[model samples]
Target: MKKLLYFEQDSSRIRPIVVALSKHFEVSVAGDLLELAATLRQKEPRILLFGLASLPGAFSIHILDRIKQIMLNLHEEKLASRSALSVVVMHGDDSRWQQICEPYIAALREIPFCDIYVIPAATNPDELAVSIINIKRANRHLRTARMSATAEVPIIGNSTKMRHVIEQIRTYADKHHPVLIVGETGTGKELAARALHFWGKRSHHHFVALNCATIPETLFESEMFGTERGAYTDASTRMGAIEQADNGTLFLDEIGSLSLASQPRLLRVLETGEYRRLGDPHPHSAQFRLVSASCINPIDLAAKNKFRSDLVYRIADLVIEIPPLRHRAEDIPLLAAHFCSHFSKDAFSLEQNALDKLCAYHWPGNVRELRSVIARACANNSTGRIFADDIQFLYQWKFEGNSQPEVSA
Candidate 1:
């Protein structure tokens, strides 16, 4: 079982956590910062859960600074070697806790800490426990990705429509204005944006891409603007994504999915090119180009009150529509040859008849689907010549009236 520590001034505030965490781990509850620091030094914990409601009314900046120092020192000492020990700062609302622990919260966001999650003060113990489990699972996935070094993303495409995308990428490779890429799900919207950034003048700098739809709404501001030391309950000091992309390019994919509540904050950042870190009074300018992509049509969403029109107008300065693969049938063979060479790296040549058949299919999934099919065929075929069977596998289930088909790639 893992060892877990909880730090909170009020024992009552941590009662639920102690009971819940004890079900799976050896949990210790601490009443004050000094006690918690001493306990941590004596017995290292796999995870640390902070209870923000226990902060005293007279908690001063000096005390908060000391707590942050303790956290940093503890983390460094524990992480001297590879270990699962991680810190989690849980705060209730945007109250005095924000001002008190801003530094700790900032630090947690960037390094040392695993995650900084915010919950409503009224959240039940069961829900909080589930949240912790989910956070751990997410961090595990992050670790895996870091280790693997090659996790294929969902973006796929191959038709002439995609060639037009490549063309647009080439065209915008030198421009400084923001480019808005619009497409449907699995349409390679992000891939196209990244291609532009990589082939652009800012290619040497960072190409920070974020999915606005997936980030928790409560973290949107902090993730984008960064936070100062001791700004909030768990904050220490960390730079936001925009700050990280200061000299490069920032790609905001799935921009349409951002919560309506958080849209205005993003708009403010775009309008002024200036933003204040969480708990910090001074605003900082992050000089970087913006590239945003959306599957949903912002115009339609705005008319329906689903998205902010003002942000749409500001970001859509250079709108580039990536056509679906069905319309660009001419590029099918070209993309197939490309994928065949890429995945097989052999002298693989597609039979003209098989190539023609691939061009006839109406690909609803666009270039992404074609790439998958090509990759599968290349991986399975031993002979250099790809035949009809290679391309036919994608539609085998449909002909056999089966719900599932074997996927090779």
Candidate 2:
């Protein structure tokens, strides 16, 4: 377990947070400023939790000045080498606590921590675990720089196009900008979205994916922003995907299907980080990273007024396009063998004929279609090796009334 240095004086009140975090990290609690400094020296914990709620009641400029001096002194003392420290300042969510903590947040910003998180006292534990794990992964990556030869891509495939996709995922992981993935259906758009979320800074929170096309426009707003009890006939209190994905990622799939009527609503939340539940007059704040995917050309759709141009601009901060499987035929053999192994009972191999057929096939359904074909082929093949005949004859059924075009073998 990773070490966590928690600096909270009133452990009785925030015991739940400590308990929750203990499930993930080895929590070392410090009761006061002096104990905090002692724990920092003894534990050398990279991940620190600041108990800003326990700040001095006196609230003197002198007290603030003394705190700043201590922080600055630590900076100078640790300046000789880089520290692997990450900090989180937790505060209550109510009005008065927000007012009190805002200045302290600004004050801590002046100190040089690798990253600073201003977390709410009421944050969901599962989501908090995501944040903790993200930081832990990053820290491990940083420490393993010496083992450079062992570096690897979390996503599969060695094709040039896939490599480009991987590179884009890596580049955008650290940034808070919204990402838009464009590709044909079955081209692993959601998989790529997962790569972005799990490998990024916000990897510690929930990655919520909603398919706009699958959901009706009548319920789109309610689905995206949630609904309150009695808001509609038989409506019960519920949190929307956006609110649930707070400080995490919200992946909107088939983004082209987002209705124009609901587009402005999405735009408002993305711009202001605030949304109102159905029948609720007051707006609630939710800060989440937006990652959207579309099979159609959003730019072209915007030109035709099918998609909201402003919403497109807000969500497409970084865009990645995955090429169709046909365009990356070199990866087909590797992908085919992978799927074949997934279905086969014994050690698996793909015959050259099967690979040739796969490469020659018109992949209308892209990667997903290919996987299904390989899976079906393996189930039919008693022999450990997959041959061309075992593969799905996707074409040649015209007289039987298959809609797809017939092609010569």
Per-model TM-score on C-alpha atoms: 0.58, 0.66
Residue 213 in model 1: lDDT: 83
Question: 173 in model 1: Cα distance from truth in Å?
Answer: 3.2
Candidate 1's TM-score reads 0.58
Residue range 146-225, candidate 1, lDDT tens digits:
45432232234455556566777788866878889998665677777767766665554456778998899999978887
Off by over 4 Å in 2: 1-154, 399-409
| lDDT (C-alpha, whole model) for all candidates | 0.70, 0.73
Query: Which pairs clash (backbone N, Cα, C closer than 3 Å) in model 2?
Result: 130-204, 131-204
Candidate achieving the largest TM-score: 2
lDDT of 1: 0.70
What is the RMSD, in Å, between candidate 1 and the native fold over all Cα?
A: 10.4
What RMSD does each model have against the real structure?
10.4, 7.8
